[model samples]
Target: MPRSWVDGLEARARASLPAPVHEYVAHGAGAGTSRDEAAAAWRDVRFLPHVLHDVTDVGLATEVLGTRLETPVGVAPTSLQRAVHPDGELAMARATAAAGGLMVVSSNAGSTFADIAATGVAWWLQVYLPSDRTLALPLLERAVAAGARAVVLTVDTPVVGSWEPAGDRVWDVVDPAFTRVNFDEGHDTQPGAEKALDLGPHDLDWLAERTGLPVVAKGVLRADDARRCVQAGAAAVWVSNHGGRQLDRAVAPARALPAIVRELADDDAEVYVDGGLGSGTDVLAALGLGADAAFLGRLPLWALVEGEHGVGRLQDRIRAELVEAMRLAGCRRVADARDVVGSPAPV
Candidate 1:
């Protein structure tokens, strides 16, 4: 078989990147056990192929927090896109816009909120709240002003530590002009940001009251925490392990999905999962398991690094793969994905 788009992207990215850049994207905290397992969780879950069903067309479009996207293959927030490529999230944003997909901008994103938002794609702001709420509020303000449709509050990285051996390569490669415009010291202070983020349940409600945009709590890995997020005013729960970057041993998001879906079955909140989701089949499987959408992070970054054409190419390949998977499984829409889910694929 021809090398999959995923396989090619990884090859080109690894070949193009230096040691430190490679470590930055690939490494996990501590021993990296959870990082290794993240992909396996999805790989183990397979579809029970359905036959003799019409699949002339597949409806890839879905809505998240009111934003309609061509497909659920959203771009997860990866900070310092400039560190990876000169255009950073700007290129990714434009690509997403061209394809009518969604891109979530990180608080630490190298591109300015306005620059990313200017692409005209539906974008969400991913905030890693500083220990001081005062420092975080302006960022939220800027996001709203810049046309962000939703605010994704990353609750996992309160005080994440890094173990990338060549972490400094990012600083070496990124331009000094590169900065997160929303949190510039002139706009938001940097004091106390190094400490754990001080946000709590009440803060979520406070945010909801202050910002009209939907508040989504990212990094939740448990059902109770997810429910608490809903109680605290989060419109949705983003089930993630920070790609195993924050905590070394955190459970895979896929492994934790069922409970969250079961527990919040009655709640109004939508649940999304985003660890090691790389293939269209994985996206289809996620939908089968009850995820509103599957978010793609590293692959898109690699695509952007390969230049503009790569971005659209990778996304197109993923959608095509999903369509193929859906055809084999007799799924023609997001709702049909669940119908094809079967027991875990044999290891």
Candidate 2:
């Protein structure tokens, strides 16, 4: 049998990475402890497959933030793509566009939004709110001018999380160099003040009043937070734990989805999730649990690290995995996934 694209890509990523990044990718407590636990716990919940359904015309198309996507799966905003590949966000954006998927550009992206948006794929901007609107407003404008379809305001990262070198082993691993060409780094404030930036509904309302693009509040974990985002005029709520790279004890997005969804059940806003999603089953699991869509993080980084060819290969493999999982679960479309999501487990 041919080696699966993901398998090959993972191998390539492992081989190409500098020691520090490789370790970060391998064992970083991305997002938090609960995120790691939830992902691990998900693996233990085996799918109870059903049979004899008309699996023909399995549709993966879905709409997010008014933009139509061929699949519900999207690449979440992750920093430093060039650390994975030279083509960086450009390659990932092209691959996503080719597959009719969405790509969220990180505020800290090694490549600017303009470079990623140039791929003609549907892209959203992810922002880490600065203490001053002076810094934040311009970035938002740059995203709009760059053709970003929406804005995802990350509200959880109040401070840069402590990043201990993975393991006791120390090695020479210089941080990869790349520029956020569109941003003014000199104007970027200190982390403490940046973290204190008001990210409440007032901020969302302020942003919405200023821009025509839709606003999505990312990093929501509680039901009240989801409700507040909707109340604030956000078009969507993104439940994430910053890939467990921020808070060590933050609740896993999956564990928090149901309550958040129920809380905002009356709201028109869409709900999305990201954290420890590794397969099609994970995608289905999220939708079942009330997420309108699921964002993938580390997986795409691994793909990018493997080089240009790895992008299409990785996307295709994930879609194929989703299709097969859907078929076995007696689901024929992305929306049908809601039927299979069981009750949320206790936190």
Question: What does the lDDT read for residue 169 in candidate 2?
Answer: 41
Candidate 2 runs further than 4 Å off: 1-11, 24-32, 44-52, 166-177, 189-193
lDDT of each: 0.81, 0.77
Best by TM-score: 1
**Reference-based lDDT, residue 186, model 2:** 61
Candidate 2 lDDT, 157-210, residue by residue in tens: 777666566433422443424535567666544443254545568888777776
What tens digits encode model 1's per-residue C-alpha lDDT throughout 214-265? 8999999888998899998999999999988888898988888878888889
The number of the candidate with the highest lDDT is 1
Q: Which residue pairs overlap in candidate 2's backbone?
A: 30-243, 30-244, 30-245, 31-243, 31-244, 31-245, 32-244
- C-alpha positional error of residue 208 in candidate 2 after TM-score superposition, expressed in Å: 1.4
Model 1 regions more than 4 Å off = 186-190, 195-197, 344-347
lDDT, model 1: 0.81
